[model samples]
Target: MGRPTPDYRRYRCTIGGEVYTVHLNPRHGRRLLDLAIATGSELVWATTWEQYANDWIAPRIGLPSLPVIPLTSDPPSEHGEMFKTPHVAAYAGRRPFVWFDDQVWAEDEEYLRVRQGLADFLLIHVDPMRGLTSRHLGMAHEWLTLTGFSQGS
Candidate 1:
């Protein structure tokens, strides 16, 4: 019930002209997502998966259909953040947020830091190969506690 391993169940993926396999232990993800949701954190899809996350990944991970962040064909950020960073920042729009992604980079953090100003945020980078873990949830919970969200604000 920790990181996803090569020996875990495999799911084939053929999206965006890339073909690969993903190994997942859905229980861990389900548990983490459930806790996040229960603690009043809104979950939204901000991935290339887009609607497919609601159609596929959510069900497997026992999550309800969450809102999808509509990605644009806009160019990358001037500061060299991920292509999705601008859209994510726009969607978040001054609200505190915690973004989780496998591709999060320092540039993305910097962009959000500058964009959000005094608003608090956290970025949890999931290892594409290893998947999420309790430690990741611990980080989220700790952030929530420090931000006063754990008390159900």
Candidate 2:
């Protein structure tokens, strides 16, 4: 009748054949919100706010309504909302998601790094005054790639 309900908060869709069932984490791609929007990706926010899409994020990124997920918990950062579910990695699909934060996913778990193919494990870190490798995220990406999890395309 209509689009099937979203199974994973983030997932690469395959049920309908060649279409990609994917959801973009607004918090994770705030900077690339415009990039994602331009790419026809969806955005999820947990609470209502000034229409960033209609006003700024959309005009720049060229998309809108990028649906908000509506959070029932505190935002992970002061600027954005938190993931609807912390353990919901399934929604994130198998893509190497890059999230903006002052910290890593887990500080005590050796950062659960993972990679799948010869895709150059990459992360475009954005900081006003820092280089692309800020937060040493590339280091983590490298770690994942080196571990034979990622093939580095």
Candidate 3:
């Protein structure tokens, strides 16, 4: 959900089509919150994990409860945008926003570019296997700085 553990140890396995195991931790959450504070960015849960992210993942990562993008069903995929793409764009509305997700695709980027109009947007794709890293955070921070989205700016 948020950061990896101190050693960044995590285990994931798929025992069957219906059964799986996953692990989570907190160090990254603190870094993320710090970044949010510095940038004046509001962090919201945009994962398929939904409210479950707030329930199960946030606490372990030391994050307070966050707003969730209500995703009850997938929007039509006529444009090949991922299921979350339309929902994310709608939730963002007219606000400039940066989104981090493992499933983001080029189609999603194009969709957002047109959908957001003049609103600034950034989408960073996280590698599911490696999870979030300092490099990802650095990129996000750098993007914020370049876009003049930080508090000091």
Q: Global CA lDDT of candidate 2, please?
A: 0.36
C-alpha TM-score for every candidate: 0.84, 0.30, 0.84
* Cα lDDT tens digits for candidate 1, 1-153: 445675457778777788766675768557766767666777789988889777767777678898999987786568877888888888888666778788888888988887555357788898886777778878887787778775456
Q: Itemize residue pairs with steric clashes in candidate 3.
A: none
lDDT of 1: 0.76
lDDT of candidates 1 onward, in order: 0.76, 0.36, 0.78
Best model number under lDDT: 3
Q: Which regions of candidate 2 fall more than 4 Å away from where they truly are?
A: 1-56, 64-70, 74-90, 100-125, 128-153
Residue 27 alpha-carbon offset, candidate 3, angstroms: 0.5
Writing each residue's lDDT as its tens digit, candidate 2 over 76-109 gives: 6432322432332234445444343322233211
Q: Which wins on lDDT, candidate 1 or candidate 2?
A: 1
Given candidate 1, what's the lDDT at residue 74? 80
